[model samples]
Target: MLKKLGVLAATGMIMTALTGCGSSNNDLTTNKDTAKPGSEKAASGDTGLLNGAGSTFVNPLFSKMFSEYSKEHADVKVNYQSIGSGGGIKQLTAKTVDFAASDAPMKDDELKAAGGNVLHIPVTLGGVAIAYNLEGVKNLKLTPENIADIYNGKIKKWNDPKIAADNKGVALPATDIFPVHRSDGSGTTHIVTTYLNAAVPAKWTKEQTGKSVKWANVGTGAKGNEGVAGQVQNTPGSIGYVELAYVIQNNMTAASIKNKDGQFVAPTLETVTSAAKGALTTIPEDLKVKLSNQPGKDSYPIVGTTWVLVPENLTLDKAKAEKMLTMLKWAVTDGQKYAGELNYAPMPKELQDKGVEALKKVKVNGEAVLK
Candidate 1:
């Protein structure tokens, strides 16, 4: 259950303050790679800077994309802040950032607040991995009922009968189970909650679902995906959720999830790719679609697609708008090659073609930004 942000009626000054809270200035720079003696620089000189912020889930991927993008396009620099999805939407609604990235699509009300002229371009697909820190528990499999109950403080011990039923052969420790959760507003939370709600409708009531939800007063809370991962790593018998990439990079153990086909599936590039296949068939004109609980036997249960939020009617100065659109176009096209290395599923060819069409629609004043 994603929070449907209401009309943003904040004044210009308030918007500026909100923007400053995340990044000191809009025009920030990252590492630069010097050009070789014979390499060609970008066509334009002093192309204005591009600024964006949002979605820690996609931050790791963006970091690589932006850094590499800078190496080739020295004339323009892109700066993106890895704030939570909520912060990104706030900045976008306030019209402060040049663009925003979100793992969850913006709601209808959010679109209305932006003058109904925004575009959600699909960027990548990933799974919401359920990672744990159980010593000697090499493999773990979780059911929707168990996951929902754990977060709600119902299942308190690692050796609980229900858990033991799932892991028949593994040794069960009688240790207390700690459930770590994201304290900040996050798209990761939304995806997890959405999946829980879908998989266990009777238990995960609508009221208990959101990007920010009132936990069951159980385990401690951490600030970001990194914080949750760190907490689970340090605290034995702790379980937490994060993007699939974090689970890999942190060397944490992830549980196999029971998919719609009644098969236990682990989160991997192949399984996440299976989930994205479902999204490909049903994506709408708005490009907002859910990828969780897909029907395939191999589809990971908690997967989601991340998106880039750009204004349909561009208002930036010609140079900045041109540069921004060019970079965005490259992000969906050439930049996709970088996704797999980071455990993100690149948009399939059909979706990539549609993404290209969407980016092509971005216009300044009245003319198309790209040919």
Candidate 2:
């Protein structure tokens, strides 16, 4: 039985702080492509900063990129608000943020109504680690079946023999089990449910569930990644899942997960990137390729891509709009170098090609950013 997280619980969240890797405080205040003798520099005649909202999952990484990007180009500033994916999309549709951050992509009609194209740039890759706290338990490994059992409330204690069976020689505990989950419409929840649905279809389903599931299991509910981290840290015998970034930042012990490739891999930059290896040249003209449970030996599976939501129209302030496009271009290309150090995967070369192609659709004065 998979845990349905839609319900609430009373507890705390445990988070681990892993120093972000390859992060740079490099900023580009002004967009200037020094032209060759006769080459033209790309500019929209607008020079200012841009502000964006949505996607708490990528907030840490984006913040690093923005801060680094700000150093050189004080003229332009990029600010991202971690308001969660659902809110991000709503903000994007409402024209609130210059760009939206979402783990998930927009739907077809949603794209149409906006009268522009949506590009899915998977700038980073990571997995949701099931963090837990227990007595005398330093390292706990878990398979998909065990995760399913715990969330389903089928296994109720830290010392379940079934789990002991899998980890074989590790000492088990007797603490009461507490499960933590998100309470908002999160892309993180969507990635986990997508994994459960794939690994154990009979118990899971074919639904496009969000970060917080209709968790049938009983536990506490937190607001965002930070909220869940707070909940788990305060509670004993508590287990909750969040992106690898949070797990590292909070200093929590994460469980080993079985991936679609049939190998049980721990959440790491290496594993996460391996799982994202085979994405299509163009993410389905519709963005429905579930990256969880992908099949491969090195593939850790259970991965998710963070997407940038840009509006097709230049209906907003011109200076702000150009700055938004500037950040997107840099983040997807140069800034990606920092992904691994942050425990995230960089976009694959081919996939980046697809991304660059999709970004071609982003326009200002009928000119493509890639151009």
Model 1 residue 112 lDDT score: 91
Candidate 2, residue 348: Cα displacement in angstroms equals: 1.9
Candidate 2, 34-77: lDDT as tens digits: 21111111233334546566676776677667766777777766
- Tens digit of lDDT per residue, candidate 1, span 1-371? 11111211111111111110122222232211121211222232434567676787876677667767877988767767666777778777776678888888887788898776789998888889998889998788899999999999999999999999989999989999999998877889999999999999897988877678999989988765666777888889999998876666656788999999999899988899998887679779888778989889989999987889998897767677888888988888899988877778888877877888998898889888888
For residue 357, give model 2's deviation from the true position in Å: 2.5
Q: Give the TM-score of candidate 1.
A: 0.86
Cα lDDT for residue 185, candidate 1: 77
TM-scores for the candidates: 0.86, 0.81
**For model 1, what is the error of residue 139's alpha carbon versus the real structure, in angstroms, after optimal superposition?**
0.1
The CA-based lDDT of model 1 is what? Answer: 0.77
| lDDT value, residue 318 of candidate 2 | 49
